[model samples]
Target: MITLNSISKYYETEAGVVSALVNINLSIGESEFISIMGQSGSGKSTLMNIIGCVDRPSKGQYLIDNIDVGTLSDSNRSRLRGKLFGFVFQSYNLLPRLSAIEQVELPLLYQQIDNRKERAIQALISMGLSDRIHHTPNQLSGGEQQRVAIARSLVVNPKIILADEPTGALDTKTGLEVMRIFNELVQKQGISVIIITHESNIAEQTNRIIRISDGKIIEDTDKIVKVKA
Candidate 1:
């Protein structure tokens, strides 16, 4: 339910203008899982930022569920982002002092939501962290902490999740478990998940893969061409 049409993002540098993304076009569908893969400086993160509404494209059109992002004001952009997108990062960006439940509740709390604790607990439970709700970041394993990050993202009940190298810090087994949770979020919760990763195995698990190079999408493949319903 998101489309990027003829988009370009550039930054002015002392050396000159540096283009981060160029002539990009993409449509992310509802209930679909897509992976954005590329080596460093390949524009994957730029694309993610644009999609996440954390930053606007330097040029080109972005429509999220048919709303033109280019036309939104700064306040509107942040508001729309909260309404539409949830974000998870590789760093497990949890507040050091907030318990897992508290971390999860933060999103809803910022939104001034009611009964947020109950919703936060349920979200953590969905991420398999019900037993660790009261634990702080220092108390959880890397994977558990990442799950807490995902729980926080889910607390707001956004339509999409943008995860960047979600498993980078975890051991293989734990990474797989984290990936499984992401897959479950897709299959069960029906969230549109867009993950940016360099790992091939992780990328393969997604429904579709979009590969980028030199600031442009070089490959977009639907695994199995189609999955049997």
Candidate 2:
């Protein structure tokens, strides 16, 4: 569903150009569950941002279902991001004042979707937060808060779920609960999942593990050896 061809990202700092990603190539298929593992400064998050359309690659091509994303206008890219991607961040990124249900409704609100409240409630329920929908972020536990974040992402029915260190803030049991929800989305809904994580145990849960170092892919467990005709 996604392809990156010879992708590179560089920043023009006072010290001169610094490469964040170099000669990266990857393919992610529909319904695939993959983990991107790398240490700090390894460019994993940079790659995720490019994949999710939050940042454009400094060079090379990014194609989503064969459409060249590099060619899209800024407005178009935003629209594409809304249509195709849902994001869950480690920080939860929730508005401090909004209730869980309200947080989940924000995405649909932006899109002007109808029956947004019902949809948001359903998403929260799906994430096992039915009883906590009326609670604000400060009122919930870390895992519950993260579940709210996941609910917000799912309310849009996005094609791909991009999670950046999704379990970084949670305890082990809670993290597993979150991963279980992700697995369900992939198995039952055919949604693709790409998670950025530094934890080996977490990476091993996914169908594929891709390891990056110094901004380059060092290993891909499920990389196809040949291009399909």
| Top TM-score hit | 2
Which parts of model 2 have CA positions greater than 4 angstroms off?
224-229
In model 1, residue pairs whose N, Cα or C atoms come closer than 3 Å (at least 3 residues apart or on different chains), thus clashing, are none
Across residues 1-229, which tens digit of lDDT does each residue of candidate 2 receive?
8999999999999999999999999989889999999999999999999999999999999999999999999988988898789999999899999999999999898788999989999999998899998999999999999999999998999999999999999999999999999999999999999999999999989998899999999988886434231
Q: Estimate each model's TM-score.
A: 0.95, 0.96
Whole-model alpha-carbon lDDT for candidate 2? 0.94
Worst 10 residues of 1 by lDDT: 220-229
Q: Report per-prediction Cα RMSD to one decimal.
A: 2.3, 2.0
lDDT scores in order: 0.90, 0.94
Candidate 1 lDDT over 1-229, as tens digits, reads 8889999999999999999999999887878888999999999999999999999999899998899999999988988888788999999899999999999988787778899889999999988898999999999999899989998998888889999999888899998998888888788878989999999999988989999998998887852355532
